[model samples]
Target: MRGPRTQTERDDTTVEIVYAAVTGVLLAGAAFALVMSPVLFLGDVPITTLANLWRAAKITAVVVFAARICWTLRRFGRR
Candidate 1:
């Protein structure tokens, strides 16, 4: 068996995990959109009140998450 990981190794692993997670999320979202686009239009689902609210919430979450990630990257780059 090998010894425990060093600080640098742990940091690298953490960075890799975060990058993979973000990439996976983006790719999954894209794939989902591509696959669901046709089905969404096929249905006559009206853009009613609750539907708009849910969509707004989803958009807000995505925007906030993106902003936070960008801010963190900028902060790190300044160091």
Candidate 2:
């Protein structure tokens, strides 16, 4: 049974949440771009293939984003 958080602790948590969100978005974007980069270099790909790649990129981005946020929060909480 932990006591209520102090003001500083609450502030720290808020900062951590924002930090996690920012970093998560950046990482997710990078992952998405990396996954979709092949589309940029391959000019003759079929539309279906492009669609599949886009889907994969979106999935990768979502997974990366969630993973990053969870990782950041877990790491911060241990402090």
Candidate 3:
């Protein structure tokens, strides 16, 4: 027979579940951005120009942020 979970165990499980959910959401968002960003590009602007480079930087920042969020969430989930 299985024993009932202690309060601390229940809290830990809840925290782990939340972390997993957050990581999943972040990964999905990152994947969607990766797929859609190029399709919504700014036409008429050359890729080598400052304006296009700035757009690229913005997308890179978003991807980096999402990756970091997922990394942190996984680290916490393992605790």
Candidate 4:
């Protein structure tokens, strides 16, 4: 059976919603970066540096996000 919800649970739900909104922004930024990674045939300009930077940031964001979720779960489980 489902347990009664506490203030902490409500807070976590709010946090998760904020996290979801942030995720949309992150995905949009990543997609933009991927598209901009390659250049048109200028015959001189190399691939952009922002791609690598954005890629690294994306990976880090995912890891930290998973950690945040775990933290939220722990908080919810507590009395």
Candidate 5:
């Protein structure tokens, strides 16, 4: 078993967590906007299709957010 984490290790973890969350939000927002851009740029889209696109955008945002967080943590752990 490993020993307890030192102060610097704890601080590094806190920093990494914050970094992951911030970057995740930014990346997720960008992904959501990208996915929903068709609604903004295209005219006369049907309401149903618009709703579907919105749903897809939300899903994409969530996936991107989770992925970024996991990737960041995993990469940090590997270092």
Candidate 6:
């Protein structure tokens, strides 16, 4: 039989794997958004809102990355 793993050890392993994956996904997504968001969201907005939407998308991307990191940490302990 396989040896037992305490919860913390399992959690650590899961976190290490998932965090790496999430980090990659977030990075790729952010790169795509940085290129496409300004065109999609602000392409036709007035002068002021154009810049605003671009900035907002960027800020949101940062928040998304942060949230994913936290989620990876949080999901570690789950069965």
- Decoy 3 TM-score against native: 0.50
Over the stretch 1-79, how does candidate 1's per-residue lDDT look in tens digits? 9899899978966785586558545754665465446546667645674466456556655665565566655655565
Residues 1-79, model 4: lDDT tens digits: 9789899878877886676557655665665555544543334453465556556667765665565556655655573
Q: What stretches of model 4 exceed 4 Å from their correct place? A: 1-48
lDDT of 6 by residue, 1-79 (tens): 8799899888778767777567957774776477556577545668667667667766776667666666766676474
Model 3: per-residue lDDT, tens digit, 1-79? 8699799988987876677667656665666566445546855655567456566656775676566667776787586
For each candidate in turn, the TM-score is: 0.48, 0.94, 0.50, 0.40, 0.93, 0.50
Q: Candidate 2 clashing pairs?
A: none
Which is superior by TM-score, 3 or 6? 3
Q: Residue-wise lDDT of candidate 2 within 15-76, one digit each (tens)?
A: 99999999999999999999999988997899999999999999999999999999999999
Residue 15 lDDT, candidate 5, scale 0-100: 100
Q: How do the candidates rank by TM-score, highest first?
A: 2, 5, 3, 6, 1, 4
In candidate 5, which residue pairs clash?
none
The models' CA-based lDDT, in order, is: 0.60, 0.97, 0.66, 0.60, 0.97, 0.69
List where candidate 1 sits over 4 angstroms from the true fold: 39-79
The TM-score that candidate 2 achieves is 0.94
**What does candidate 5's lDDT look like per residue over 13-58, in tens digits?**
9999999999999999999999999988897899999999999999
**Deviation (Å) of 58 in candidate 1:** 16
Task: Estimate the lDDT of model 3.
Answer: 0.66
